[model samples]
Target: MTKPSLQILAVTLCFALPAGAASLSDPFATEAVTPPRPSPQAAGRSAGVPCAREIPAAPLTAIDAVDLTLCNNPQTREIWAAARYQAAQVGVAQAAWLPNLDGRLGSSRLWSEQRNYNSTSAALTLSWLVFDSGARSASGESARQLLAAAVATQDATVQSLFLSALQSFYTAQAARAAVASTTEAERAAREGFSAAESRYEVGIATPADRLLAQTALSQATLNRIRVEGEARNALGALASVMGFRAGQPIELAAPPAGQPDAAFAQDVAALIAEAEARRPDLKAAEAQVRAAEAGVDLARAQGRPTITVSAAPTWAEVDRVSANGGVVGVTVNLPLFTGFDTTYRVRAAEAQVDLRAAQRDSLRNQVALDVWRAYQSLTTATQSLRTTLDLVASAEQSERVALGRYKAGVGNVLDLLTAQSALAAARLQRIQAALDWYVFRATLAQAVGALDYSLLEPAAQGRP
Candidate 1:
């Protein structure tokens, strides 16, 4: 009857809020979230330093190499994009807290006996989940925690690529050093052969001496050739990691001409604690555990009662006659039974929380072990550097004395060659020790989550 219709119209008009009442800000926007930080070198260039995408004309330094790798590497872009995806999920969860408004329109024509009529209707409905236990809050919290995990994962990936860049750069430098050492050995061998030839021509040296010196020269030449190839291979590897073609030329700046310092000497227990606190991967695992916990709350809330308020206003026209009416209602939904879906969901969410906690604990132990191994390796490398320096010095003196005695006809060619061989081996060991020390230092810094621009500073003055 008209009375009931009029009552419905009155309630609709009372609840039909103005569209202008809605919040102005977009609920789905993610601009508030911060992205991962770019490389410090590239950021520094914004102040005054010139930055170019192309390879620099000058030789590349370790810092420059890391910057290029971070800027051009596909992994960096992939990780940050994933973080942005998680950020979007956060926005989606946030949007759930706001009300929803829907509009509908319909037109229909009816024919009966000898009569036809058309009716058109339009309606606007507004629904607000005034209460849903704590489902909305729990979902939002879970989304935020997952976003934090994503950002932390991004940081961990960046650190990994940084360490890889350092490793490749150091390897290239070591290879070049090997080439230089071999070249010097070849020159020494040639000088010895010339000395032996001169002595033999003057009837002061045996034929065997001349032949031995020639054989030594050949071996030195072969070593130089082999190391030259290795140097090129190392450079190619460095270039590849920097997002360049493998065969591309990449000249590296000379390595620091000094022994590594003991600046890394610290208590292992303290270092492990620092790593546990600072490591981004570990932080990410913690966030995952928190997010899983939030999921459990959300699942439990889903099974509880939900209260929603809805209002709809309608306008209709039939046979040139108009009518205005609407209905306003509140819906309370309580899941009495759903084939035990909610029960299983809550159980699954709880299990997920436990799983994540276990994973986090496992990663914590691995982090401690990583710090310990890196610390020990660095310590061993440092000691080796000092010992190799002394070995090279003694071998050099022995070679000089043997060569001098042989040239003066007071020593045999065998002694001279032996001393020179020892010097060559010692030089190689010295190069290896330096490479190990630098690499292990970077590894330790990575394990501690402290690898950054400060570690890329030029070498200090000291013996290598």
Candidate 2:
């Protein structure tokens, strides 16, 4: 009889337990399985479209590249997302100024001394913070400043992306020019080799001359191969920056023919001043400083008094006897102590303000340095461009004379080869100098916070 009674008591206790109580069979329960979804490419195919297909094969220009990058690049999208998230934070801060309402319902059963009783209750409450020593106002201001910073950050990202696309586009163009130059050199080498062979067969040129010409041809061929590879690599880089897969086919328009912008020739000090005034990063830093200052104010305000008003309306039932009641009250809460937590928080916020100010100063110094460096680089490239143009003309004239004399048996193969090599080198230098000038111009624009897709357009059209 005792064993039966104990068993019955255990069974009663198990049934009385709440639904949320742990069960012995929990670890043995079968896990829920989720069905796998199709991959993105497969899903696209199912939707009657393909992923990673080539875009319309238009002649891509620097401006087109910039547009593509801004549209497709993940960095730009990521920054935009961040800006949206910060905007949401601003909304959250604003919500604190509004009233809050809550509703709750509860049921209970009590058993004592073999007697049972049941009760049910429901409540609807409203709370409105009438005052908090300007804490809400400071918080809202801080959120607004943060949102401004995020917008500035997005602007800075756009400029940086434009500069990157510009570099890749110009690099691809330079590589293409290099391939053309090498092809010209190879043609000249082939002509020289043919002349040497014909002269040797006629007993006018020695075997050494033929060998020298052959060696020149080989060198030119090798240079062409190397430059062709470089051209391919540069194209791949351009495609990547334009937010396409590497090795995507893209035909680029010829770069515009123009000197560096007159703006780049301005005084470095003036450039620095412009950068300080216009740089998006600097603006973002200033906004951060403002936000940090607001944070300090918010922290200090936390130690002050808060005033709130609340109302509650409730319904209750016990053993089928029901009653309705309501409450309305006003309260004041003064934070007299919190183990010095508020004091520490205020100090930390003040330190953060100082840190942001320091960062802004540091960024200003960096901007000045960037302007100085870009100014020097642009000047050097401009000078080199003029010198290389002269050098190419002189080398070409010398090569023609040497080739003519060799064909007439008056000049040696060595002199002809020498002139050919000089012309090739001069051509390559001219191409590199032109590219450098363009790249440095973009760099200077970026340093002055003037880099934009409009700036990449043809200078003859108008400067942005």
Candidate 3:
């Protein structure tokens, strides 16, 4: 081949190869590439909190547990990632407003009989849709609304995780209190059994009385065992919610004194109103409705005419002769028919709008129900707290009297056992009431979108 022909072929070959191809090889050759694994440091960073080698020495409060859960839980990170993805979608929507530029390169070698011909061309094209009947604007608006909804949903997820951690903390505390109460009962039973054996040895009590006292002691021991198991289970649950491994040892501090009456002073009506205005899930639903409405506009615009401007500058080499040219045009495209595809799309978009509207209304009703239920629960727990305290006081006095009577040969073993059991039950009831009060208080705050770390803090009691 002549020098000019050779130079033309070399230039064409340079542009013809794929951008990332290796030198002196076909551009489209297949090669398997292994995906890279994350380094140890990167993996650790993404794995959240590291597992503890030893038990936590300090007592954890509800606030501390919530903070740990937010920092270490995978669910919280998943929500954050989703929000970031929506942000990227917003950027993509914005890019639709700008023009697009694309580059193209081509080469071909043809042979017929005994002669060879070569051609190569390169072009730079710019295309801008100058008018689209507001389709791009509607799409951008829809994406922005969806992004807002994603952010609201992420906030709701955080609130949910914190509530779970708080409830688990309260449950663990209640279980521990039950174990203590049961231990006290067991001690009381052991003393009663010893008294019954002494009385029988002196011929003052029958063998049956000793047997009854032994049975009571056995029952108390069994109850203590059961309660201790429950306490361990509760601790495991707390650890799981706090983003720790199962069976990890964790000590919990006593819950702060809470003011149930003061917290419940706000009426259900006001709470419902607050929930409607502040609840993140409800806000997300409203945003979804707006997004669906924008989608309807976009679907309608899709069937209309679009006006676009296009231009291209071209260079070509044929038979070693270089040539250049340019082309410009304005085009209008109208969809005449698409087998009813556009018609169905618009209908689908309209139905989605209706669906979103229904969802928003449904969420509003649910928020109101949540507030009402939480308010009622708080009131019932508050009342039970007072009643349980009275019951405990009475049960304690009764146990003391029965034990003294038995010691003086006036009361039977059955009376002492009954009194002891009642005292234990009363104490457990008091613990349960307190736990319920705290749980309902937190639930009400969550319903009103006011649940935060502050709710777990120590506050002045409205009643002692």
Candidate 4:
């Protein structure tokens, strides 16, 4: 009989619970089934690299790789995350337009020698804001502008990070080429030394000549090893930037092998103009100024009036006794002197507007400076590439002449070794110049606000 009575009471209580709360089961009664966490090794990525979901068909060259494929890159994901967070901001601002709703419900039964009673009650109330001197509207607009700025900031960061990754990858490639060139030169020198030693043993070449060949070979070999180590470090740096797995392959697609296009505009003036109009960084900053202005309006509106309506209903039962009642009305809150606080706030808000405007103006000048500096780097890189190309061409010709002379027995071994070293240096300088041009152009692109990444390219093969 007691168990049946308890069951009856439980059923009554479940039916009388609030609409939303009725569905809320006893959380403590349910055993939580948690998903297995990923292994630590599998979860950590490089400090800043994005995870690329799919490896590309071919190796991705610096200029051809995706900006930030987050499969392996966390930084890329971080930039994109701002847009997602802004969604919450939208919800917060829009909340003002919706009516606030609240509710309560309860049920109980009791029987005693002196009394027997059962009671049930439920209430739903809604409150809506009627006026606030446009404060709500201003606040909503400010939130909207801030959301836009966040999106813009994310875009700008994405562009900058991807461009940086691309450049770092290119630098590593050039370093690899430099190491290869020096290694080959060392091998050639060692072979020449072997030949000279053989000739000296046969009394056909002087001991001085053999010694000179040995010295050159030793120096070349040492240089090769050092440069190869440098290349390895460069690869490591690039791997760090990619945020890929330690042993993961990072193939690069070959970039277009043409020289940079002809100079678009002469100097910093044109570049500054372009940045002011197009740069995402500056655009985001300007948005802050607008948001701040709205903030000032909001603070001033606090000195005015606000209208709201509130309603509440409640019920109580004890020993089978019960009572239920509710109240509903509108409220108008008026501002009065409270230590001249509102007056001070108004003054502060006006000063903040002035500060924001000044900051905006200052940033405009700073942006111009950035554009000018990047533009200058691009110009210098162009000139350097031209000079390095000429140097490489001359070294190639000289290496050919030395090789021919050595074969014909007219040139001393020292001349051949010297020419070989010069050719190696020239080749490395040319590659470095090309890499500089590539990176600096990307920088200039970012500064001038033209940094749209084409997601079409995939990472190429053979990079690990």
Best by TM-score: 1
TM-scores for candidates 1 onward, in order = 0.88, 0.84, 0.85, 0.76
lDDT of 4 by residue, 11-73 (tens): 544543334321244221111211111111122222334434554556765533443332346
**Candidate 2 stretches greater than 4 Å from native:** 1-54, 109-118, 257-264, 459-464
Q: Can you write out model 3's per-residue Cα lDDT over 11-116, one digit (the tens) per residue?
A: 5446544566534332322221111121112222233444443446799877667766766677866776777667667656756765666779999997889888
lDDT of each: 0.84, 0.80, 0.79, 0.67
lDDT of 2 by residue, 237-327 (tens): 8888767898888888876766444344556788889999999999999999999999999999999999998777778898788888778
Candidate 1 achieves a global lDDT of 0.84
Query: Alpha carbon lDDT of residue 378, candidate 1?
Result: 85
lDDT winner between 1 and 2, please give it: 1
TM-score of 3: 0.85
lDDT of 1 at 299: 95
Q: What lDDT is reached at residue 109 by model 1? A: 93
Residue 449 CA displacement from its true place in model 4, Å: 1.0
Better of 1 and 3 by TM-score: 1
Kindly report which residue stretches of model 4 are placed more than 4 angstroms away from their true locations once superposed: 1-52, 62-64, 67-72, 106-121, 202-209, 254-263, 311-326, 339-359, 403-414, 453-464
